[model samples]
Target: MSAQIKNGTILLAEPFMLDPNFKRSTVLVVEHNPEGSLGFIMNRRVNMRVDALAKEFPEFDAPVYFGGPVGTDTVHYLHRKGDLLEGSDEVMEGIFWGGNYEKLRFLIDQKLITPYDIRFFVGYSGWSDSQLQEELEGGSWVTARMDPNYLFKSDPEKLWSQVMENKGDTFSVIASMREEPSYN
Candidate 1:
């Protein structure tokens, strides 16, 4: 396995990942390095409403996403406005992650940023340095470069299947299979 995963890519877990949190999950790899990896689950949608968060933070406005199983209470965000803010890091081409509450508030108040332009996530996927590398070697994930269009997709419910289908013939077949293949 490569020591580092190319940034701004998708990590699709193999069907064998029995962990309910990750089974058939699609993750956006925002950071991958010797220090471990961090990403947000792109497929899972929380039941919470954006207005609820907007009321709570008042300063920030963005739709929340299900990051992963870890740090469920923590909030994170991904945006294309990396260059406009301090402390933001690019995870892939045209995609950036991190939070600057003050800057976010300013952007929101000025109407410079909106929920449509960014995604908020609760918690994040984390791997101990070297742990992700091992998983890669074990075939737990298949990596693909990121697509900006997918990041801001309006319909996340189909995003996972869409991504897997784009992986070419092999994954297309898998994507077409029914979730309960045994019944077929």
Candidate 2:
């Protein structure tokens, strides 16, 4: 791949993408290798909270996000807890994803990890070998350096446009386009 697509790369969906699953989605790539790639949609928060989906989870007001279309029945998480959560893989300088689940609960119960330290998701995006490369070549996604603030702080509804505008130039122009412009 000509582009340095790697862990922590943020894949911004092209403005007029038609795929309902990822239209205007901002995906944070957590794993990318020869076999395939895995990531979570960072901006597509579902209308449900995490505790509503799991009684075992510690009491927290955080919402559960729609990570992607695949593995909708499963759960995943991204965090800034680092080694504090055993087995958590560092996706970049500061972000981590997944780890020993039971240990995570233990840390949460101990008041070591707060809602701001982690974000949960119901599923994740996946790409087969060469699939993502093909999509990148086709312009379905605009790759950007993953920014933690975009994932942790930006308003979910404004994330796609915010990231696009931050790109500053062609991307900003694209960000300003109407979601559905009539040509007739």
Candidate 3:
């Protein structure tokens, strides 16, 4: 765990992580440092439509997601065109986070970007840096390098299972296991 977890890394929750919000979840770590860590849950989707959000915040149009149970009022976005905007930081090679709001608005208005091109999250999942490292060591999370393709997945509901399956046969076995095992 000597290496620091940074943006774009995928965090897979361990089988025993009982927190209902995070169990069997895959998260994209968007920020990390000594101060704390921040990320969004990749598998949770809110029923809200992009057009609905666009109507509410006519200045911006994007897809919405359940980031986590934390700060539900704050908005965060993950994007592939992140480099084009100031303050955007590359989470992985083709993915980034935190960019200019005006630029986002322009992209949305021009139809240059679609809801599938970026994900909007309300609030975010956070962990103190030490806490995250501890969780990693405890086998509460499996860290993997991220690919931008995973972030813009068309079917987020299947993203978690797909990621776990990609990890290999061992993880595949885990993915197939029932949440609550039955005794015959």
Candidate 4:
């Protein structure tokens, strides 16, 4: 992987990826190290809401996303509320990952956290040490700089193409290709 591909970087799965878990997905790398890499797929929304998945969670209407194929029973979150949410690790200048869950509920109950301010995930994408680097070298993924807006303001259905186009150059062309080639 390029040196620039690290924490807070965005990983766009190559346009033609065949893996059911990641095909056409855009992922946000929240942690990267020599040990391993951890991220959430930014574009795969689940058909359920936060309250529907967790009985203890406050009755907020935030849609949950299919984070990845690993640890599917766990819950995670990314948000723009670092300033007000305690224990939030800054993934980038304005984005945060994982914070106090009780506090999160309180904030939601208090009407302080809007659905637009946060995203919930049911699992994460992980790569063993050097695994992601190998994938990059093999053309399974492409890197893009993370924009806070991509998480909070963009539509999940269009995030992959949106980020690809924003990457410019050849990537912009890649963004326009059909998800699956016609083969005609």
Task: Point out where model 2 deviates above 4 Å.
Answer: none
Best candidate, TM-score? 4
**Each model's total of backbone clashes:** 0, 0, 0, 0
Candidate 2, run of 10 with poorest lDDT: 175-184
Cα RMSD of predicted structure 3: 2.5
Sorted by lDDT (best first), the order is: 4, 2, 1, 3
Off by over 4 Å in 3: 1-4, 54-62
For each candidate in the order shown, give its overall lDDT on alpha carbons.
0.78, 0.89, 0.77, 0.92
- Tens digit per residue, CA lDDT, model 4, 122-160: 999999999998898998999889998999899999999
Ranking of all candidate structures by their TM-score, best first: 4, 2, 1, 3
Error of 3 at 62 (Å): 4.4
Clashing pairs in 2: none
Candidate 3 local lDDT, 25-133, one digit each (tens): 8899888878989899987888775556543354444558888888987778888787566778887787878798777777777877777678888779999749988
Q: How far is candidate 2 from the true structure (C-alpha RMSD, Å)?
A: 1.7
Which candidate leads the pack in lDDT? Answer: 4
lDDT of each residue in 98-134, candidate 1, tens digit only:
8687787677678788777788888899898888888
Angstrom error of the Cα, residue 4, model 1: value is 5.7
Error of 4 at 24 (Å): 0.8
